[model samples]
Target: MDPYTSFQVPTGDRPKYTGKKLVMLSPDASMKNIDAEASGAALRLAPSSAYKSHEEDYIKAFEEGDGIVFEKFRIAVINANHEEQIKSLLYARRSFQYEEPERYLYALDGPRSSNFGVLLWQMLCRLFGIKKDPPEIDPDPAPKDPLPESPPVFENTGEAYWGLHALDTLANSFTGKGVKLAVLDTGMYLAHPDFASRQMVTKSFIRGESVDDINGHGTHCAGIAVGGTRGESGIRYGTASEANLYVGKVLSNAGVGSDSGILAGMEWAVEEGCRVISMSLGASVEEDSNYSNIYNELAGMAMDMGTLIIGAAGNDSRRSQGRISAVNHPANCPNILAVGALDRRSEIADFSCGGLNPNGGLVDIAGPGVEVFSSWKTPQEYAILSGTSMATPFVAGVAAQLLEAFPEATAREVWDKLVDQARPLPLPVRDVGAGLVQSPK
Candidate 1:
């Protein structure tokens, strides 16, 4: 009988593993040492460095039963189907820092039904002349000083998207020139007209998949981060208009991917010296659950190597139903900046996750997300979508701009500048950590 036969997944719940396990080696462990240890268990491991220039072969080796190690992050992905294999690895635990089952992650785009419900509510409020009560400001027993006034409400015009207006991107002089920015998602539409002339590097970590985005999620996100003007409206949507784009197809065309592929993309970004990496994907976690230690370590390492990783605070909340989910994985890792979603009214999006868990699971900032307009896959050319997924790229693009402006600043310094310059809002810190993200003027 198969061991999985006894297992039953609850409806709507994602399976915890893909019959694979992730292992983080001890800091000083090398490929030579690890190989010797694995040989004792009759296991063969392949190093990613050997196939760095040939990713297809690397993935093929992994799929062909060779335990593959990401040398930079000192992490490995191995099959976990046999009990003896797992036991053997556990027996040599001293050679590893940590080990866990790899979980599946999905694109953070808002669910269609949720987006429709939000639109309906807004329409009803407008038709009935219903006004929402002012948000109650958190009282301070010993207030140091009054908070800055909220930013003016913005509306999209033929000239630009409301997000760009809200961030004052039009007045900003920096175009993020020379900055190497990466967007890891479903992939991008290579032939998108708006981005035809821009500098771009592309790769796919998903097995048997190309970097061409079948799903529009990645194209929309890449547009928000670095695309040019829209053809019809001449509207400006992207932030870092001249940044060198690095497109990493970590998630499959189905908008789902394993941690192994995601990690591979991350390693590639860091190796290529990317200044900022934007990830609009995550797996939902319970309010009481802790973040993934593996991601936390990897993100910290990436930061030390001068790369900043930004991730979407998952779209799992139902504020209308009085439920707010905690910030999701990868983003919940302390070193990765977690961005939440905001609407045109500058209020938190109804479906935006919050910081319910302590420690690393906190929303670090907010960006325009609801009904966001940007480039989509061909035939459509453009689209309007909602979710923290939209918000994340806005922040990533701004980070690239800041990097160009302050050429000598470290990755951590850029993170500080973002929080320091954000326009404070009349909302709780749990929902909007440093308030709304703003472009430097």
Candidate 2:
């Protein structure tokens, strides 16, 4: 079957291929068999255990060889142009399990084009002095015992981001100390003053690019997950203030990346024993499209290795127009925790995707995503943005806190605790899942 036939996107929105292919081999597949099937294509096999010690060599091999095999994941990213050979390997050889064209994924942030339309309409209304009624604010119920503090509404104060207050992070005693949290995105600004005193490890998977976050999306997401207080405002915006940060530049400075780079980052994070892996990037999928088996399998493997992967549900929905899109790829994978976005009112964000499809395409939880303020690239220092991308790292930081609070718990157990401790909201389960995620008190 043609791999592309199973999924469809809008005419111009169809993802572009990277002129490469991802081939998943069986666990017992032999290197000799892969070479024989490759028809003389140059290939390199990289053992997962050697990634940490020989990180640079592994990356170099991937770039120089026709393809590189990840021994741990039993997967290979190869530069293959012979369609017949690939088909023969898939159909004739039992060693080859699956194959798909490598496609690019984008950082999931920034305002959608439709948002500009709304902004223009509001401006015209102001110019004409046309008075409009205030938007209705939903009433959220108070949390049960142990969470005695009422949920704080959105406030642009200089003390802390409203997201931290809504999750009651200030009241939590756990600081995520000793936990390893990985943020896989467009890299981070290593010299940022706010993170100068924190312990961090950094790497870049995008060829020719360093782990310097020029795109700012990764920096903002990292700020929400593990950043400290700002020097000037003294405001605490991050959640896991002391978690050991692992910054992996999977996406490039252009805010785009292919599956090979992303999967390589995932392998590194899992090998490093990171307790939580946060990915604020994804490719859009249609309502009837199924989740990628490759990502689902990798997610399950990571979970078994004691790492819980969290991803954005995508900013493809337009609630005002009554168009709700399905959860994005990877996040739609069952093992990867899918996080939806919530607005300042504790209501679902207008652009947050919904569980419009069955079989693993669902929103597992939500976080404060609208008008979220966090760290940015140099000069700007800080900025406010909105998207489900912001919500993902918020949950990842909370996961780190949970790992610190329950040091003996497994990754799966921590996932269950997040769902159980979430404060129930008066909203549809499709949008909010178990409701707003909360930190352990």
Q: Provide the TM-score for each candidate, comma-separated.
A: 0.93, 0.86
- Taking the tens digit of each residue's C-alpha lDDT, what string does model 2 give over 55-157? 3545665555556777667787766565665677788657678987777788898465666654565567669986562342332243433432344456656
The C-alpha lDDT values of all candidates are: 0.84, 0.81
Q: Candidate 2: list runs displaced more than 4 Å.
A: 1-14, 30-59, 116-152, 156-158
Clashes of 2: 0
Clashing pairs in 1: none
Model 1 gets an lDDT of 0.84
- Candidate 2 collision pairs: none
Total colliding residue pairs, candidate 1: 0
Displacement of residue 306 (Cα, Å) in model 1 is 0.4
Judge candidate 2 at residue 84 and give its lDDT: 61
